[model samples]
Target: MLVLTRKTNEAITIGEDIEITILSIHGDQVKIGINAPKKIDIHRKEVFIAIKEENHEAVKTVSLDSLKNFIRKS
Candidate 1:
């Protein structure tokens, strides 16, 4: 992983499109602001993990074979 220290208002550019900046620092938590294209997706790590876990549970409980049989008969 690439790690660097940046003070408030300092920014790091991603490729040719995205720019991530440090907005503020409070205690141990740092506030960040991102500038990216509309097509790009941005999510906090915990939120991303939650979304992934929810999708996994939904898939595990869903009947894919039943849906496939119905589609085949249709």
Candidate 2:
């Protein structure tokens, strides 16, 4: 994990494209802005983890035999 300290308006660049900038600091919460191409995906850590878990569950619940039965019924 990379830990960096940045003041307001200071930015850290990733690769040649993405930029993360410190916007404001209020109490213990710090606000940051991210700049990247539209093709890039950005998500909060918790949200990303939730999405990954949902995808894993979906894959686990899928069965070829069940799919075949459904197709036959249709």
Candidate 3:
């Protein structure tokens, strides 16, 4: 992991498109802002993990037979 220390208003650019900036600092809590293209997705770690887990569960519950039946009904 690349650890960095940034004061408020400081920013770091990723590749050529994304910019991460420090917005505010209060004791241990720090607020940050991200700038990226609209086509790119930016999600918090927990939210991203939850989304991945949901996708995994969905795949597990879905089967070819079920899809075929549904398609036949349609």
Candidate 4:
């Protein structure tokens, strides 16, 4: 992993369009802002992990064909 040090108001660009900036700091907590194309999505690590886990569990409980069948009935 590439570790970087940035202070408030500092920003780092990714590839071309994505930019991540340090917006504020309070104690040990830091607020960040991201600028990216509408096609790109950004998620916090914990939230992403949680969503992945949930999706895994959901897939185990239901199949794509079953979901399509339900959607057709609706």
Candidate 5:
């Protein structure tokens, strides 16, 4: 992992398109801002993991037979 120390208003660039900046620091909590293209997605690590798990569970609960039955009714 790449780790760097940054003070408020400092920034780190990723490639040519993304930038992360320190917005403020309060006690041990630090606030940050990200600059990226609208087409790119950004999420907290925990939220990303939750989304992946939800997708996996959805796939497991869906069956081909169920889809076929629904199509037949349609």
Candidate 6:
């Protein structure tokens, strides 16, 4: 992992479009702001993981339904 230290109001840029900045720091909690094009997606790690798992479950349900339909037709 690439780690860097940034103080309040400091920012780091990614590629040509994304920029992440430190907005504030209160004890252990840090607030950040991100600037990016609307086409880009940004999600918290937990939220992203939940979405991935939901998609996987949906695919499994679809496959099971397909198999059942195939068996019924046979």
All candidates: TM-score: 0.83, 0.83, 0.86, 0.77, 0.84, 0.83
Model 5 / residue 17 / CA error / Å: 0.7
Off by over 4 Å in 6: 64-74
The residue pairs found clashing in candidate 5 are none
lDDT of 4 at 3: 96
Regions more than 4 Å wrong, model 2: 66-74
Error of 5 at 48 (Å): 0.8
Best by lDDT: 5
Worst 10 residues of 2 by lDDT: 59-68
**Candidate 6 worst ten-residue window by lDDT:** 58-67
lDDT of 2 by residue, 1-74 (tens): 99998999999999999999999999999999999999999999999999999999998998999989999999
Better of 5 and 6 by lDDT: 5
Residues 1-74, model 6: lDDT tens digits? 88999999999999999999999999999999999999888999999999999999888778777889999999
> What digit string (tens of lDDT, one per residue) describes model 1 on residues 1-74?
99999999999999999999999999999999999999998999999999999999988886989889889999
Worst 10 residues of 4 by lDDT: 39-48
- Quality of model 1 by C-alpha lDDT: 0.95
lDDT (Cα) of model 2 = 0.97
Query: Model 5, 28: alpha-carbon shift in Å?
Result: 0.7
Write model 5 residue lDDT over 1-74, tens digit each, in one string: 99999999999999999999999999999999999999999999999999999999998999999989999999
User: What ranges in model 4 sit over 4 Å off?
Assistant: 63-74
As for TM-score, the candidate ahead, 3 or 4, is 3
Global lDDT of each model?
0.95, 0.97, 0.96, 0.95, 0.98, 0.95
Identify the leading candidate in terms of TM-score: 3
Which regions of candidate 3 deviate over 4 angstroms? Answer: 68-74
Cα displacement (Å) at residue 36, model 1: 1.2
Q: List the residue pairs that clash in candidate 6.
A: none
